[model samples]
Target: MAVALDIVHDTQETYRKVLTSMSRPGTISTVIGDMDNPFPCHYATFLTILTLLDREVYFHVISDGENLSKVITDYTLAQETSIENADFIIVPNGTNEEAVIDAMQKCKVGTLEDPQNSSTWIIEQNMISVTGTITLTGPGIKHTTSLHLDITAELLEMRNRRVQEFPLGIDLIFTDPVSLACIPRTTKVSLDGGVI
Candidate 1:
């Protein structure tokens, strides 16, 4: 028999992992409990969705068919909507960097008074090296920290645009098959070779 996830327990565990990763920013966190088979997207991404999404959330999945979106909405009972309206946006591995930026650009970046409404992105990565390749600083870091990424400069620039105004920026969760890391709006990021 296939292993099953006890919805309440598993979701809570996954939620804790995500929260821990987000709170620590560049640090890696592990997802606890069993995830049977998460297709079209990495298992980590699936579990993150399962943990964070619910009936009140609006989400968008980037793909060619409705299967991925349908499955997510059905399983979570969350509504599926356009990128511009989604509370959570999942960008699968191999998606074009520009497209990811476009979708992110359309997402809600709450106003000064309601910055908490900003969208959160769960982006999948094929690899996350043992040692970080880019540097991260600001809140959550005593000095500086590093983390590996396959993200492009365009995506980095787009992210910067959203964060220009304090308290009104997107939060990102980067996940691979086994690891999860995050970049909250409060962090100041820079790639190797002094690219900020």
Candidate 2:
């Protein structure tokens, strides 16, 4: 069908954008898709989900409403999994700090032998600002880069705890309405100039 072909093309394009952002680490990449939107989730979030989730993987949607569950399953056919077992986790915008904290706390960090089994977070933010207070330093960055999160300090604190140990933490991809950025576990995220 023409509709299916178009979806395939859009998803491929979104995958390229996500890949570029992931490889660059601190830099932002725009996901410009003209795909039809039917869910309550943000446009960027919808695109990210289409690119990352499928029947081969399991995902959990936290900090979002129930409507997203049906939408995600219908489109991606990815299993709706529990937080601890999710290969991918999504946190939609307008979610309270506590819910995000809870999801972060429960997400799997992977095992020693199979670190690739870890969960990846697709988080929707109100906006990924041009300038930020958080400093990032690691594999993909040249020296250090800054990112400002629109969420509360409590959520940041929780995320800080998640990535403390290498090969044993979650990876995060943050999306706004039009753009996305990645923070893989290898990157060190520090608040201000100090490591949290």
RMSD, one per candidate, in order? 2.1, 2.9
What is the C-alpha lDDT profile of model 1 across 1-196, one tens digit per residue? 3456567886787788887878788888876435556566767777888889999999988763527788788788999898888899888888877788888778888888899888999999987653765788888788888888889767887887888798999999998876789999998877774755
Supply candidate 1's per-residue lDDT for 147: 85
Q: TM per model?
A: 0.91, 0.91
- lDDT of each candidate versus the true structure: 0.81, 0.82
TM-score, candidate number 2? 0.91
